[model samples]
Target: MTKHHITLAGAAAIAIAVAAPVALAQDATVAKRVDKLEKEMRAVQRQVFPGGAPAFFEGEIAPDATPGQVVKSNSPVADLTARVDALESQLRALTGQTEQNAFQLRELEKQFAAYKAEMDKRVPPAAAGEPAATPASLPVVAAPRPAAPTPAPAATATPPKKPATPPAASAGKPDAARLALVKKVEIPSSGNEQQDAYDYGFRLWSAKLYPEAQAQLKTVVAKWPKSSQASYAQNLLGRAYLDDGKPSLAAVAFYNNYKDRPDGPRAPHSLMYMGIALDKLGRKADACKAFRELDEVYGTKAPQDVRTDAAAAKAKAGC
Candidate 1:
């Protein structure tokens, strides 16, 4: 029994020795594979993040880690997901800004349309009967109405003598007389009548009756110098002269309107017109100076049309 036990122990020792080398060889192969895998992972990390690994990975491990232990982190995937989220957020912001810009552009177009309509109502058509060579300083004259014939004696001589009465005023009354009366009438202060009178002058301007418009607008300015409509009338008068091809006169009128009421509703319009008139008069330097002054003085307070028109005019004048 003692001899049999010794033989079993020797067998057990030889088997243990054989198993130890195989286990050590397997461990060495596994360690080499882990080192190769770590090198490949580090190469991928360098390619992915040229600047460096993110701060979250700082000081977390030695250059080499022990084999048979797993290193696990969701950081790379989490970082990719966070970057995608940020890109989506930025895209959404840009889309919102684009929508807002489109809305503002639509609103600006609406405002421009309304302003153009108002300007159309104020501008006049060219006169038909105006001479081709009419002087710019002179106002355009409306065609004269035909005269009515005097009554002749009745064939029966004294058959019946009717009472003498003034002829009823007709719709075909002479334009000259109507225009004279328009110039003579005084503009009342703050009433419907005042508004009507101003509207009538505006109608004349729209009809291309420049002489009539000038006369009526001048009367409104003279009679209601302190009224709100005075600035409007003055500005219209300047435009009338400008459209009539009298640039010097238009410049003077526009300057007067701006000088008299720099804060008036029409002041910026007057300045813009003044610049146009100066340009028409071949005084480009003065015109550019006027445009520069307009921006310096009004900044954004000027109407959008005035601002746009000023920019266009400035470009045209090469300012």
Candidate 2:
């Protein structure tokens, strides 16, 4: 009877050992699956929130859970399910925010396009093949005639005859010589044909038609070299080249204006713009020299606007 009892015990021990390995294998498989799920959750969190996963969903110990005590479930499946639920909630929130940002970006792009269209309308392109109008020539006046000599009064005449009123003055006409001189030296008229031509070019410039404006202004400058508007046309021609991204050409135009008419009203402005064009060309040293010359020559004589612009340009160039 004692042998029989020992045999039964040995057989039970072998069975128990076999069952223990099977249970351990099942547990290992579950642990591996749980690890995989956790890794997937971390990847999702990284995509959703680049800064970091939220503290609440990061598997931190609950405030009420005591130190050294496990708050998670003993079953790995249950723990994984809970983590997945938290990740799903975070993903929903992140997706909504991303959509909102995308919508805002699209709206901003539309606004920018509309603004550009409106600006384009304000500066319409010049019509093709339209000829520029010619200015009318100034009228010439003839030189005054010499006055007739008065005959000597008779000795017997009791009273000198009153001096006869000049025929030209009596007719209310000005002296021809004086009129001619006045017309030659008169200030430019704003309503004259020359001014109108310049205005047409100025309108082209306002519309950002740099090529057309440059051509028109050149014609005005060449045709009316002695006109008061010559300085203005030359200065604006330089600006056209500058605005059209031809800084080298703009520098030449500006320099010419300054050199040709240093004391003209637009000379200081031309010098200031020359500095700006040189700076754009990466010739900062030449730009600084231009600015210095402007200040040295014009000083307080420069217009307030020109001086202000020069100062700003100088500061930007570190001059």
Candidate 3:
């Protein structure tokens, strides 16, 4: 009997384990459906507004739209804006309607009051402690409507008021001069002997001269290896190789840069690309760990866009 009881309990446990995956699969399907709906909403918004511009410019509109399409789309979007201005004028006129309605209601109450007064005159006054005539006992006619609000005068087209004079402390400071100085403060060109080399490497990288850029970039790393720009140059070199379709070489470049300067501004991006290179190599597990490191250390500290990109990659890789 004990053996049978144990067997029954084990079967129940097996059933629960089987049910768990089924429930999770259903939830995942529901989540995917929600994602699909959100995508549809975005597609509809794009169809209505077309581009990335704001709601107002959404109708900046294509010249080639068919007459029917234009007519169909002739929304109150612009008129609504004009109506916002018209609302002020309408507010002034609103009191007129209220007054007109109140006057009509007041006339109605007065007529009813006069009729009551005439009927009461036809009946005798009742003695104290005695019941009064039914009509005499009736309540007084309705209260009179309150007086109308005075119409506001139209706003005059007053000349634009002069801008107020700024206070002394603020006026004494020349912010424009300060900004001009800041804008002109170019990093010293002749200050460092290797500046030309660094600048040339940057130009080459921008031009997509990967191998030549790497060669020029190496000049800076070899000459001024301890400088801050060395990390930037190394970051660019890894990018160059990645763009050149050399993932392994790119990984080597990024890994070396991170090893040398793990706390760099570019380090997170470098590590991210290293993971990409590993992904290209089909080393997914290692790639996942590398991505995990980015989340653990710098998720909050990193830029939002970078964090978003990293999270998306992690999700796509199912890590």
Candidate 4:
């Protein structure tokens, strides 16, 4: 015989002998596992599908069954359950690992999509019903609003010796002094923010920057018509006009202010100032009406000093 053939025979003999015992042991283990699975399955089956009543022997010639009939009827429910349970356990162990691996793969895909999004600034946002993002896409920024309007003056009036009054509000290139005043004079906070506007307005008025202050305060009243300070700002704006030698603008301010906030705390002042400003504009009927409104609204509450001063103006204006 050839040396290769002899070697081949030796290896084959060893492999068969070793494989035989191992195979037998594996079969025995499988059988034992199957039996154990059967017992557990039968216990569960009894709880779920217990058959009806048992028969027993009566003492005196009764027609009933004796013990050991469980085997005679070929009741194989426990055996069937055990066989099914053993197969299911093997199936679950094998398939459960594969299912877990699939879940991990899906989670990794999600992480990759998020990582791609963070790096791309130009990518559009995800839309409703849209597919998930991939590495090729990025993010985007939103558009901004139009530029804010040029700030108006705090008060409304013309400059000294200026016959024509310039537009108080400008678009792109606004007046420097007016803008400066607007930035410096923020509308104050209050229950009646209009009144806060007016009070700050008064501080501006006392400073003698009447036109700018009037415009700013007037804006507060215009923006918040319901504000308690609406009338105050309006009336003060009228006064600012009169001080600036513009009776027409003053009349407009006072009239607008009074009409908007009739019961305002500054109503009396508004009415009185409108009468004075209108009287200066040679509008007598308009002036008298304003004076009468002042008298009617502020009967007792009108300060004696204010009434006296208004009375003097009315007499001077022939209202």
Candidate 5:
């Protein structure tokens, strides 16, 4: 019985010695595969997140674990599947961000198109060879009526010889002394811009400074074409030309006032002046027409001065 026991112990020891190496080799192979898998996972993390990788990627769930305890999955396939899910989630997030960026770009394009259309409406086309107008100097709005005639710069300004008499009818060019006087004329700034401009022009006209008056009146019309003073400035401009003996230019100025602002305070005066200008131009028939039209349009509403002037002009022209 003792010998049999010894033989069995020897057999058991040899069997254990041979099985140890095989088990150790299997464990080493499994550890090497795990190491290779870990290396591949780290490489994927670096490629996916160049900034940095997330922590604790192997054990995703530990619902019943205490502090410092994790329930790790033994299967490499489960870990790889979890990583694939993370990659898909990141791709979905990137796709959503791209869609949002495309939507914002479309909105910006729409806004730019609307702004361009608005600009086109505000600015008028420049004439050939003319520089484009700056936005600061552009007109506030489009004018409803045709522009008035532009007067020649031939007429000049000077003090009249007498209160009742006008400056001498000549080339009407300003000498150095007259220009110096014009420079001395005070342009008021009493907070009423249109009124102040008109007042300055009126003073120039009253002083028999026809050229300066014409220029100032034209500026008033250009700067504030919608102001109440526009009518007054336009009518006075015609008289300035008439006093300077540019009867043809005067006729055009007066006719424009009457046609453009028929309901203006100075419309009747403009019509009467227009007839006088036409008479000076030796168009008796047209002068007669102007005088007759004034009586027909504003028979009773005409001012006393306009009425008296019109009647005298009619008699002189045999209308």
Candidate 6:
């Protein structure tokens, strides 16, 4: 009987040892599932709140509720069910929040697009090639005409006499007053037409009448493009603009002179002045390029005065 009792005890001990390993394996499987669920929760949080997870979200999953903690559950299934329920509830909340944020952003974009359309209608775009008309460019409103005097009685009538005033200049014509100003500045004529036109422009430029000089020089270039005076006129036109505080226009004029008449007598002068104009327009790098080009293109052929000025300019520009 004692042997039998001892044998029974040994069998029971073996059974207990086998059960322990199975229970441990089940616990390990549950832990892995819980870890996977936690990782999925974190990924959802990142997608929902791109900036960062909120404070409440960071602390939402209680440490004591984790699978690592000893939960008083009747079975592993019950523990897994509780954990899945919690994750599903949080996931649903995050999904709703993401949808709400996307809706708000789309609505904002629509509102902005509508407002832009309204503004565009109110302020029409400018026509191609034409600048928007400013207040100064608007046409003047004419004064209302007075009612004609009641016609005189036939017995007392006298024929209407013409007014003794000079006829007004026609519309779209050059102003007579401006022409009179041009005529006032006298320039002695040369036998050569090209020379005479350039001399008149030069005289106007010397007198500090930059607008008139620009117009006159343009005329000289237009009328005698093949003449020797064309080079001088183009260079002087650039100088006129430069002296009038229009460095931008001056730079263009100088570039045209050199590009169109490279072999002309004043080509080097134009290139030098182009550099100075670019410098005045606050373009140091472009100025350096111009100076470098002047050296490369003209070398010793450039006038002494131009080379000296270019050297000074390069130093000033730190080139």
The number of the candidate with the highest lDDT is 6
Worst 10 residues of 5 by lDDT: 127-136
Task: Kindly list the per-residue Cα lDDT of model 6 for residues 73-159, writing each as its tens digit.
Answer: 678655775776687677778878887988999997797567446424532332100111111211111112222322221111221
Candidate 5 stretches with Cα past 4 Å from truth are 1-175
Error of 6 at 38 (Å): 85
The stretch of ten residues in a row with the least summed lDDT in candidate 4 is 127-136
Q: Cα lDDT of all candidates, in order?
A: 0.57, 0.58, 0.51, 0.52, 0.59, 0.61
Off by over 4 Å in 1: 1-191
TM-score of 6: 0.44
| Residue 277's lDDT in candidate 2 | 75
Which residue pairs show backbone clashes in model 3? none
Count of backbone collisions in candidate 2: 0
Better of 1 and 4 by TM-score: 1
Residue 202 Cα positional deviation in candidate 4, in Å, after optimal superposition: 2.6
Q: Per-residue CA lDDT of candidate 5, range 100-161, in tens?
A: 87799899779756643542342222210011111121111111222222211112222222
Reference-based lDDT, residue 293, model 5: 74
The alpha-carbon RMSD values of the candidates against the true structure, listed in the order shown, are 19.8, 22.5, 43.1, 30.3, 23.5, 22.3
Candidate 3 residue spans exceeding 4 A from truth: 1-191
Indicate the worst ten consecutive residues by lDDT in candidate 2.
134-143
- The best-first sequence of candidates by lDDT reads 6, 5, 2, 1, 4, 3
Model 2 C-alpha lDDT per residue in residues 35-58, reported as the tens digit of each score? 544554565555556657354254
Residue 88 in model 4: shift from native, Å? Answer: 99
RMSD versus native structure for model 3 = 43.1
Whole-model lDDT, candidate 5? 0.59
Off by over 4 Å in 2: 1-191
